[model samples]
Target: MQAEIEKLIVKFLNRTISNEEEALLEKWLANPVNEHVFHDYVQVHYAISMDCIDDLRLEQSKDRLILPEIEKVRSLDHNVKPKGFSIKPYLKYAAVLLVVGGGILLLLSKANEMENPVEVVSESEVIIAPGTDRAILTLEDGSQINLENDSIYEADGVKASRAMITYNATKGKISSEVQYNYLTIPRGGQFYVELADGTKVWLNSESQLKYPKNFILGETRKVELVYGEAYFDVSPSTEHQGSRFKVVNEDREIEVLGTKFNVKAYKDDINALTTLEEGLVRLDVDDEEFVIKPGQQVDVNKLTHEASVKYVDVASEVAWKDGVFSFKGKPLKEIMKTLSRWYDVNVVFEDKSLETVRFNGVIRKDKKLEDVLGIMKSRKINTYRIENKTIILN
Candidate 1:
């Protein structure tokens, strides 16, 4: 019975099966047991299709269809469906019928269409490169500092706590002789620095970092971010006193006793995002307060005062800290924004239609503007010329 079914399947797939054989095959497949066998055959046929084994003549001329060998099984005590039944015959037959039907459909659909195929080439080439020479730092003394280079400066030093240089001065107390420094990251540029208190900071482009030259012990340890993005791996105060870490962006305040987290507060973005990588954090806005745990993020809309907590992809969120641009189905505008900061170039849209395009890929920071733009073009996005360091995208 199985051999007869196989022969019928082959003939059906070749579109040469008699009406009787087609009816028999369909009837056998209508049974649940036969359907199970038919499913296995379909899997094998799918594998062959993926391999592009579509030579109909070769398949039709084949004298033998080898079935996969099954290992010996223990005896069944009850009447059960036979194991290792082959359905390859049914799938081959189905494939042939589907292909023929599809071809017919295509022919009918294109009956009124032109025969010539049109080739499209994009005409625009506007590439948004990353930015450089951006970021400003504000100091505790109400003084603002712009950091574009790797420079070590002196600050008022107090006692050391949790490997962080504790500052001795109050927020309002600025001794004429005591120097405090703030670091600012301009749009399109990022910087890394170690404060006197041993706190490591990675400032994103167009962001700012404010800390004392040296943290004064017994005084609350705080840093202010004017804009942009940053990641902090704060050190705990000695004896587990837990240093106070606060990040102020616009009207939003993120206070943490000691935790590792990332904050993105770009001016162009609608909301400020704080993702906790480890430990805990208390997010305060206006009079509302929310506690964030590890693997959670708080999104605060600076304009609407709306806040929500959500789970996020930690690796993708912190990829910028590792000097790579990783985008997962992000629109072209958002991607261009990141490139604009990294390459320090303005992005102008020449073809507004392409702005809605989304892409999924990883771009290394070391890639040149032309190389990156070429990739976009391959995806049907064109870039125009750069006008005065501005990338015109078409």
Candidate 2:
């Protein structure tokens, strides 16, 4: 951090930067190195002033501040002055305006895409990098294979492509006995798998799926999501000669009526949610049964074993598979939990009551956690700190 830059940041924070100085600052930020440097200043300043970040209004103000001069000029009226102003309270003010956009780091990194783009450093400690496609596959023989997006692996009849693992069902991959393999996607990781049955499964972070390398014909085709979340697109049992397709997770099970759906049964969550996108799925609770209609979600309380179904936004429910984190009036607690898994961080709330704060936004999962946090800072959504792998939210 440069001394002159530090002083200028303070002046800017105070809403006192002159037009000439503002132009100079913008030029400095245009450089990737300078962007990371300014990012540090904001991080330091934000941590010191965390108490007063504005809610929704501050976010708009910050967005206004960060917009290109052309956009600013285009949107300005003859009577109004430039929108530069102080973000109040903690860095919450500075956080959203200077740092938070929550997507800044990711966007900056996206711009560079070099072998090693810079990161927003915090007190010399490195924050957790955003997760990529990575997981571990266990064969029936207990052999473990690490999966990465840059490489491919094959075993038996399954071929792991850079994007997904696909089984060559046309080979009729017959065996003397069923050999089950398991794919476990750890926290902060995701993967895709195409079953021998031609079904497609998008495994979410912290999820696992157990299925055989080959589905024997004349037998029921099935896979179990032992725990966590996954979006399934059935290949239609009709193609498999009317072979039954079943997805099981603990006490709940779904009999795929040749359809597509998402199952979220994370071990830590109290509700097992099954949201239908197409076709039909029969939900089985113990011996009880319910059929889910398109655009409807079935919420089964794991603790109470109670079940209920209602209509929901299908896009929001399935957004993760499409590279977005979409939410509608979701509580802070729930949102953080989802983020924690994707970013591989632990969230501790200083203000317990803040957990229920409702928010609705669609953010890209590839964005650095801080940038996403910046967007939340603007919402005046909550306050917090990142200490190593722990996010202490106030």
Candidate 3:
């Protein structure tokens, strides 16, 4: 499967892939990490192809692609070239250059193609920075530790770095008592964690999760999404002696057999949303069970205890986990609610009718609050004002 996707990516860059093949490649790239993989491939393409290009075209392409002003990207010089460049040997590890300085060109290229790229606001103006890798780790003993950039914590068979915490695998060892730890992501914060059983989880801003420090062998691995949203990539049951995984909240529970899915159950939301990307999942809501397939979503109403399953674009549903906010005709109210949590600000809709105005686009989460609102203003969707930490929609 990976080989096929990589081949398709090569064809895509060579401008020879069919529409159907492009669709498949796009589906695979919908996940943000996969998108990073795609960029790495693009980096290799440039690295190899530039060696075969003429000096004049190479310099022109550099001028078009490089954007040094953006903090995330750096300028590329056309005159400089690696002394020894060979095709087969270099391609073997060309993709790994993304870690050093290869991906900046791809980032700038993406921004240039954006219909409404985030415009930089004035330096004198109030700047609300985007959320970062930050969270609160609550140990079983009721003690709490702040997790953020440049900070590290290691204890209780777990290790935490600047942005993520990982638990050591138990290796089939069973503990007599279960010890639970809580990870809470405050507003303007996000985090990632790997459980003892190898399941990876991404928590969004204003979310909390509770899970056992180590799962007992031959038992169902369980966790709770106390609030907000999370994306789960469960390790396959085959590797764990068929121990299934489960995620639960107050209103619903998702039974999984090693799948990748997303659940959004915010405190103020009217419904609990569960979207399955890969593998299968059984959702239990209000004592009713519904199995969902890939590209499907289940929305369980909190007020009426009703559940509905519908096919959806799995990419858009999980884009937040990839550092993007993707809206497909989503209403103003819904978009603002998401921004409110990530920006840690209050939102006021002065015009009641504006709440229902729909929008369609993708915005990177790394942009400042004003930069996001500016995109809406450019479209004549609406105007906004930031007073202190509150956003007023007019």
Q: Score residue 171 of candidate 2 by CA lDDT.
A: 47
Model 3 earns a TM-score of 0.72
Instruction: Please provide, for model 1 over 241-275, each residue's C-alpha lDDT reduced to its tens digit, 9 standing for 90 to 100.
Output: 45576777788888877777899988889989999
lDDT scores in order: 0.57, 0.69, 0.72
Give the poorly placed runs of model 2, Cα more than 4 Å off.
Answer: 1-66, 69-126, 171-176, 378-382
The 10 consecutive residues of candidate 2 with the worst lDDT sum are 105-114
Query: What would the TM-scores of all predictions be?
Result: 0.59, 0.71, 0.72
lDDT of 3 at 337: 95
Error of 2 at 138 (Å): 0.3
lDDT of 3 by residue, 240-341 (tens): 889999999886889999999999999999999999888999999877999998888999988998999998767667778777676666788898999999
What C-alpha lDDT, on a 0 to 100 scale, does residue 228 get in candidate 1? 81
Per-residue lDDT, model 3, residue 187, is: 94
Worst 10 residues of 3 by lDDT: 100-109
Q: Which sections of candidate 1 miss by over 4 Å?
A: 1-179, 238-240
Superposition-based RMSD of candidate 1 using all C-alpha atoms, in angstroms:
18.4
Candidate 3: global Cα-lDDT? 0.72
